[model samples]
Every structure is written in structure tokens, then in C-alpha cells.
Target: MAGTNVLFTVIVILIYNAYTIDSISTANLEASLDEYINAGLKCHTKNPGLALAIVKDGKVILTKGYGVRDLSTNSPVTDRTIFGIASMSKAFASTLLVKLLAKHSNMSIYTDIAKILPNFKFTTHIRTDNANIRDLLSHTMGFPAHNLMRLDPKLTRDDIASRSQQVHSIHPFRDSYLYNNLMYGLASVVAERIGGKRWEDLIEEELYTPLGMSGSSFMTKVDLSGNVAKGYGTDDATGGPVPIDFAINRRWGQMGGSTNIMSNAVDISKWMLFHLSKGRNQAGQQILSENDMATLHRRRNTITAPTSEKYFSQPQVPVSSLEENYALGWKNGVYRGYKVLRHTGTTWGYSSLVTLIPDMNLGFFTTMTGDDPGYKFRYLLHNYIGDLLLGETPWLNKTTLCSFPEPWYNQSTSVYHPINKHINPTRSLNYYVGVYHNSMYGNLHVTMNTSANTLQMNYGIGSWLLYPKGTHDKFVGEGTNIVHKIIDLSSIQFHSSNLHGRSTIDSVKVISFETRAPPVFTKTSSHVNTGNIVG
Candidate 1:
């Protein structure tokens, strides 16, 4: 009896020891996830309008909302709040393309886009007779990143497709991966043609619905019924949050293959799980085939050069690397010793980042409804979460790196001014009234169209307008800060030059303008008795 009692005591002790070890392990994991959340919140406090989520092994280890959804009303953010995932929509849309390929075994990414859109052509640009569909997905078709398309608010996917034919490639096809949103917009058109439905509808039917992402939608104008994070932008002058109201248009929405999708962290976690499972849903339904999944995550291009001189300071290889490899919609690279698959999205007001470390089965999604200030919070959170997952201490400074000095979290009261309202008067109809000459662009004529109240500066196939800024000078029609204050007419100084024909007064050059001269003889020749012909 004494020996049997001693045996029972030994068994109880072993079981208790096992239970304690399991408890410690669970606690450690929870602590790690907590540290990530705390670091994310700290970053959010600095930028005030960010939503973040972290997932590991198909489970949302940490998900939290920080700051207010609407800075104006001071409404707190919630887990279910919707955010514009921006270009992350491309990842989702790309997943649908992969799924379609899996369902139809014969479909190929290498298939000529012209197969779906017969009128599609790259015959005009790069001397190429045609471009492949993969070029559009990989962003190597050589179209300009973005141009006049943004100005035409009515541009559609088909319009973008037709315009792509006129785009000139700087290099041969597949020579380099040049990120182009316009090209992606054109790709969406191909998807529409092949799927026989809108890109949004395809995503809903195949990806979102199957994955049970009920809160996910491709709608730009989000329904206000549930918690919705209002989009914000930093005022260029004041460095404060400015609320932006964007209208949902088909052109923008169909750009879903590139940007334009709204989702909550909860729904996005499901997306992470789907990717982690290699395109399998929660119910074990294979949403995409293994081959398609492999193709989407494969390295398609090699980084031959730094993305920019500034990017050299960072350790990760730029998306410019790899060749013939396509990773569906995600750009695959290594960052900070980890295999990173990431993409960034931006609209006028919102910014989003989605990063996945496939080797570790870890994924992160961060959404900021505001501008650059908000993105600072995102970077901090991303790094901190990464550190926690790797069992390292979080390291991020609280100070903002914004160009301006101001409270990073403060909201801006600056009003939005229309492009027409800010035009300078001197540059309106009178400044460009005379003829001008340039060494490179050649002879030019500035005409004032009084009926239109616009100054037309004609050059080649393109023309720019100098709208009135104040009473003295005009502002360029399409100028961001990067291209702003180009050719300040207020500083123009008149000088006489004898080199060109008779002595003609020339305006002093302020900012460099690159444009060709208008046609010399639009109207018939008029010869005057002064021995001068003005046509």
C-alpha cells in the first residue's frame, strides 16, 4: 500500500510539471504579441489616425485601433473600422487572377493581353509589335508612372488601355520593372475582359466571399453605418491633418487591380490566413491552386540598381531586382534578414502597407487614413511589431521626420482651394500675349484666350495653362510641390535680344519650362508694309 501511494504521488508531480511548462510557453507568446501591440499604440499616439494588425500562423495575435477615426469629431477608432487599403487592393485583385488561373488549368499569365482586348496594342511605343499580359502585372511595360490621367477625372479602364498603346518604353520589354499605376489600371481592363465581369465583382465572388471577409469591399465611398476611418492629409503649409472627401468613380474603382479597396483589420486578418495557408480558406477550400500560388510568390525580377540614391541607406533590395519571375501582385524581397513580401498603397488622403514574411508565417497590415504624418506612425508600428516577433526590443524615436515643424498629431484647418481659384492674374491672359523663343524648345507663342479666361502655352502635342495666382503672376496648371512654382511670371524681366531677326524683347527666364513652340503658320500669311510678316 505504501509503494502504490508513492507511485501515485510521482504521477501527479509529473503532470503538474507539464502543465506549468505549457502555461509558461503560452504566457511568453502572449507577452510577445502584447509588446507588439504596445509599440504600435505608441506610434499611433504620435500620428493619431492609424489602424494596425499583426498575424502569426493564420491567427490574429494582435489587432488594435489607435487615435480617432474622424479627427474632426474625435471619434475613437474601433477594430471594425474600414480603411482604404489603396494599392493593397492590387494584392487582392492579383489573388483573384491566380485563382482564376487555377480554376482554368490552361490559363497563363504569359497570355497576350490582346487575347482579351483585341484592340490593345503596344505597337506605337518601344517599336514593339505587342506586349504580354505579364508585363502589365509586373509593371515592366514602360509606361510613365502617372501623367495626365489624374487630371481627367472621367478616365475609364478602357480609356487607360487605349492610352497605354501610346506610351513609349524607355527600355526593351522585360529589361526592367518600372512601377506604373496606369499600366496596372490597364491590366484591370484585361481582367474585366477575361472574367466577363467587373474587377470588383470578381474579387467579391472569388476572393472576399470565399474567404468570409464580409467587411471587405471595393467601394471607394465607404458606407458610414459602421465605424469608418476618415481620410486625412497634411496641409502642405501648416503641417496639420486635413480631412479629404473623395468621390467614388468607376475609373478609380476599376483601378482596383492597382488601388481602391476598403477593409477592416478583422477582415484583412482572414486575408492573411488565406495567404498563410497558401490560398486555402478556413474551411479547407482551396481558393487558389498551389502552382498559381507559387507563381505569384516567385521572384520575377532582379535588382540591378538601387531604387533611388536615398533608398541605398536602407538594407533591403529594391523591387528593381529579379527577372522573368512574378510574385502575383506582391513584390518579394529580403529586408532586415527576413524574407519580406510587401506593397504600399496611397490615395490623395490614405496610405496602407501590407507585409508578409512567408517563411515565418507572419503577416502585418497597417492603414493610415491621413498623409505623411500618419505614415510615420505606420513605419514605427511595423518596425516595432517586427522586433517583437523576432524577440528583439522595439526601437523607434517618437519625433516626426516631416519636413515641416509642427505637432504631428494636430488637425489642420486649412481649406482646399480649387486649381482655378489660385491662378495668378498676371499669368492669366496678359503675360503670355507676346511671342517667345527658346534654344531647345524653339519659337513659341503665348496667347490669351479671353473667352476661356485661360493662357495657353502651346508645345508639341501638349499645352499648359497659367492660371491666375494673385493679381500679378500665374501658377502652373499641374504642379505638386515637386513641380510647383515652375516659371514664376512675377519675376520675369524684359530684355532686348538682337540675335533673332530684328531686336525683340525677351522675358527673363525664372524657372525651366520644357515645351515645344506652337505651329508657326496656323492662319494665312499677312505681310505688312513694315517688311514684316506676322502669321
Candidate 2:
């Protein structure tokens, strides 16, 4: 028996040696992944909770969960934990659309959306004449971001379409890319019409079931069971995790194309494999044809701009390049000499990123339940993994990890005109009357009536309360703590007044005052004005 025990110990030692050797062979890769994990932990100070995965050659080299999944319960995150992957849903939706197109040669991306959903009508302007399947996927249909519908928990897709009539087009049909969710919802409608199935059902049938992505599904009104990560935000002062109230109404689930995807990294990795293999499954199932895959990767335009600083230095992969605009749903670009195809998603409490490097047969998926700070964590992880893959320094230097420079504020030199300035002043008197313009925010016109002492300032969108600061100057009532003053004309030097307290008003510029327009008074009698109000 003693001899047998000694023999067993020897065998265990041999197995351990083999495992050690294997890990050593992949030392650089492991080291790089470790560096990323460290960086991710540091990001929790700002971003809080993060989960990351790195894949190379169809194998997962790293899958890590950093920070807390539920700060209240002190539950840690795991590889199998689920997260809401906001706009990343677009990638999956686009993939399924492409797959359906491949299966039915009769269907093309250029097919008119109107043909699929005849009831679909635009009150503002119809760009559907040139809009095709490709336009929706590429975000080239001239639809302004219609987020109002999503924000309203009570609104449905039908209601959103009804309200869309009130929305105006930013440009003519197919003129430029305007990232809009309305078009995506319309695309989902097309998918349902063509596939004779709901968007979620079609995804399960075409992609999830075949790839064995069992942990992924569309978010519904029901509570997500075990393995789901709760979303968290940080307190501005304490840097502690604060639970964000996420509205998971059924109506929200209907928004499948733009948001509503819930997935785990383990399951998401399989989805990445589908892209890395260029539309094929692990078992040699042809999920998408070569031509169809190529079409998905092809540049639809020439408008590649880094969405953020973290994306700037990374290498681009072959599936897409930023030189050309839209490659299916992926943003194509070059980072560090390699072609890169990537996209990011955000809901109120969740942020997600997906990136693929086709040349290296590598892909990555990261999801976290947090807000703006989480974005920093995502970028840091991506940069670390990317540098490691490119055989660069495995760790990010201090300078490299610094925040990207803020974009320059472009001054609009267009002539300013009041939307409503021809109206008369009414009773309910006021002491406020002046021309207020922040160099940064442009002009604000204020008028006060006889009875009321309340001050009103008309800027873009609508009127805001101008709290009395002194004799002639008032500070913005809203955000007063951040913006201390919104001066009345009397408080400023005759030359010019700063806009938003940032940009300097040009003293030399001649002031051309327009007549005040009538006020469309609300129910509250804070200030009354007699003028013809034009919106």
C-alpha cells in the first residue's frame, strides 16, 4: 500500500509538471491578460464593476470578472454572470438579418423597409425611398435619434411610430449617417416580416441554439434569475457603489434592435467565434455564406471616427476598417496598423463593448452594469489586451492610460434669430428684461411683466427660470450650483457677456435686437407676457 501511494504521488507530480509547461508556453499571453485584470481592478475606483474576455485563435485566453456584481449583497462577478449589453444588440440583430438574407436569396438589404412594414409611415419626412436593409444596418437613413419613445415606459412601438410624425428629419433620405433607434426597431420589424418570427425567437433559432449560447437571451419584464449581474453606479463624493434603478418594463423589452440584449461572457464568446470564423460554427455549420459575411464586413461609407480616446491607439482588424464607414453593424477603423471592427452599447445602468480582429482570428466581449465611469474601465481593458496581442509592452504606461483629450467646442457663427420675439408684454408684471448671451451657449432673451417679479429667459428648446442674483443679473435656476450666474444685461459691460460663463462675448460685434415675441404662457402664472410665440 505504501508503494502504491508513492506511485500515485509521482503520477500527480508528472501531471503538474505538464500543466506548468503548458502555462509557461503561453506566458506572454497570460501575462498580458493579468496586466489587463490589474488595470480593470484599478478602474473600479471610477467604473465600479467590469467583466472582460479575450479570445485568440478561437480560444479564450482570459475570462475575468472584476469588482462587485451586487454591491449591496457583496456578490462577486463570475464568468457566467449575465449583463445588459445595450447597443451591442445591434451586432447580433444585424448578424441574424444577414443570415436570413443568406438563406433567402430573394431578400436583399436594399429591400425597401416600406415593403416589409407597409403601415410604417413618417410624419416628418419619408427617407424610405432610398432606404434599404443596408441603410438601417449602416445607420445611413436620415433619422434623428428618437430616444423619447424609449424613455417613456408607457410608449409602445406603435405609439412611437405615431409620435414619430412629430419628429423632423435632420437630412434627406440616405444623405448621411444619423445613429437612430427608430430605424433599428423598423429593421427588427423587417426581420420579423421576412423570418415569420419575433426578433428574439429568430436570434435563438439562428445563432444562440446552434452556437450553444445558452446563457444569452433578450431581457423581459421578469426578474433575471441567478447568474445575473446587478447594475451599479458610484456616489460622486464617496466613490461607493450606488444601485441604479433600471426600468425593465415589457415595453422596453420590445426595443430589441437598439438595446434589450442580456448575455454572459461565456455565451458571448461563442457569438464572437461565429464572426471570427467568418460566418461558420464550430461544428462546421455554415451559419452565413462567405459573400454574405463579406457584405457585412464591407465598408458602407467613409466616416470612421474613434468613438472615444481608448479606441484611438488600438490596432484595427480585417473584419472592418475606420477608413470606410459602416461595415454592417460594426464600426470599422484602424488602430495601431491592424484593422478593427468594434461597437459599444449603453443603457442607463449597463455598458458593453465588442471588438474583433479578423486577421488574428481574435475577438473580445466586455459587459458591465454601470454608467460613464464604466466606459473608462472598458477602454483600459481593451487597450491592454490589444497591446498584448500586438506584442507591445504588456502593461500600459501612465501617459498611455491618461484620459483622452476632450473634443474642441466648435463655435456656431450662424446668425442668431429669436424663435419668438414679436409678442407684447402682459400683466402679472416683471422686473426682468434684457439680452443675455453666453459666448459658449449663444443668446438668451428675457422679458419681465408688471405684476410678477419672476424672471424668464428664452433660450434654445424652451424658457428657463433666471433666478435674481443682483439688480440686473440672474443665475440659471436649474444647475445653479454648477453655474453660479446668468447675468442680466445691466450686470455686464456694454461690450459683451459670457455665455454659460465660459465663452467670451465679442465686444466688437454689433448687437441687433429683435422685437420680443408673445409668450405662450403655461398654467402656472409665474410670469405673464403678451406676444405672439413662434415655436
lDDT at position 336, candidate 2: 57
List runs of model 1 lying over 4 Å from the truth: 1-46, 125-130, 248-251, 303-326, 373-376, 397-474, 477-535
Give the clash total for candidate 1. 18
Candidate 1 residue-wise lDDT, 1-535, digit = tens:
9999999998986675445323434356556545554455444432456676777766776666766788668888776788877777777767777666555556677766776677566745432445666667776664445432333433555567766665555656777766677777777777777788887788789888999989876654456656777766555445566665444322356465777688888888888878878888878898887767777777766544422212212333121211222355777766456677876677656777777878767888888776644244445455655655654444433343221113323445556554554444542244245645443223344555455567654332233455654533324443322122221222222334465575433442423231111112121111112212121
How many clashes in candidate 2?
A: 41
Ten-residue region with minimum lDDT total, candidate 1: 514-523
Q: Scored by CA lDDT, what does every candidate get?
A: 0.58, 0.60
| TM-score versus the correct structure, for each prediction | 0.70, 0.68
Q: Which whole-number lDDT from 0 to 100 does residue 368 have in model 2?
A: 80
